[model samples]
Target: MEIHPLHPTFGAEITGVDIGRPIDDDTFARIRQAFEEHALLLFRDQDLDDEKQVAFSERFGPLEKTFSQNPAGGTLFARQSNLDIKTGETIPIEDARMVYQRANMLWHTDSSFKRVPSLCSLLSARIVPPEGGNTDFADMRAAYDALPDATRQRLEGLAAEHSIAHSRAQVDPNLLSDYQKSIEAPPVKQLMVRANPVTGRKALFIGAHCSHVVGWPEEEGKRFVRHLMETAITPDICYSHQWREGDIVVWDNRSVLHKATPYDSKKYKRLMQRTTVAGDQPTVMQ
Candidate 1:
């Protein structure tokens, strides 16, 4: 198999490997190594069904079950589609379902509010619209490396509050239903810097899920978080992926932040399934 760099800093495209079939141990090892070094791996043109997607994702670790708020709850898959699940028809722009999807456009890591955050996420493209609907990823490792010495030193040992409701509230305060709010993950404290166990690389962990710094004044904390976000998304630190049918994208949630872009769901259909690999252990604070 040949691996090609998709971006100067972070992503790689693996060609000549079909994930639908079983892979040997040595091949899987190389893939894992590439993942650690690149932070994102894309395998194109592999027709992955739910079963195949689960099998490939399991190679990384045990999968995370969808939460109560997800339409695919009780399963390992988190469904993303514009069609109404029961009717299989295009949902109107004003529908609550569409509003629910708007929250995804915000930059954030998957499952960051959990006590044990996600290790990585794998998303498979089942159907693609004619235009738009791309996924953009920011390399946190690069962001951390670019910080001034004083800023980097100050970031160490810092902790921030993270919550599911906090991120969703960015799009609309009432987007989450009252019952859904009851089921939301309570705010959890997480270090601003995380060290990758396998690579020993440090990355900034701040994102939309971050409500504020644990001990700082509330307004100051928001400004700090916003500044870090703005700095991290500078052009050289990001890579945007345009989905094609049968593309399986795996991104390390520990090392990158991602957001979805707009698509004309009113005119066309789009479907994507995601499987998250649970972080067996909590992040190591720097």
Candidate 2:
């Protein structure tokens, strides 16, 4: 397979291989190395079914079950779409159910609120919208590298807390029920500076799910998190992906943050399916 870099630090497009078929040890190793070097890899024109998707995902690790709040909860797939699968009808944008998905438009690292978080996410584009509905990814490694020396030094030993509730509150506060709010999302003490175990390169770990620093005042913590997010998502450090049918993208959840863009839910049908791989271990405080 030939690998072509999409940017200086972020994505790569792989050709000359089909992921639907079984892969040998050497091929899998090469793909793993490519993923370590590039935070995102796009594989186009692969017609993969549920079994094939699971098989390919298993090459990396065990898959994470869908979130309890999602329609496909308890299954391996997280379905992202405005249209109802059974009826094939578009869901109203103002509908309470549709509004719940608005939170995804905000930047986030997948499964960050979980104890172990996620190692990576594999997303396949089954139905592409005629317009809009693009996904944008930011390279956190570049963001960390661009920080001033003093700022980097200050963030070295610090940790930030992340939660789904915090992100939900930001996008649609009215949708959260009392029971949902009561579901405690345990805080993970992730270092502000994240170094790739294989590459030895560092990246910032802060994102929208990140609520605050452990010991700081709430306002100060929010400000710090906001600053890091703003710096990390600058246009130059990001790559926006326009989806096409049969396209599959795999992203390193530990080193990158991604967000969905707006689309005409009333006019177009867009379906994106995602599967997340569980992290090797839970996040621990130092």
Q: Best-fitting candidate, measured by lDDT?
A: 1
The C-alpha TM-scores of every prediction are 0.95, 0.95
Ten contiguous residues minimizing lDDT sum, candidate 2? 180-189
Across residues 66-112, which tens digit of lDDT does each residue of candidate 2 receive?
76676566789888888776787887888765776788888888988
Task: Provide the global lDDT of candidate 2 against the true structure.
Answer: 0.85
Screening candidate 1 with a backbone cut-off below 3 angstroms (N, C-alpha, C), the clashing residue pairs are: none
Give model 1's TM-score versus the native structure: 0.95
Candidate 2: give the clashing pairs: none
Candidate 1 lowest-lDDT run of ten? 176-185
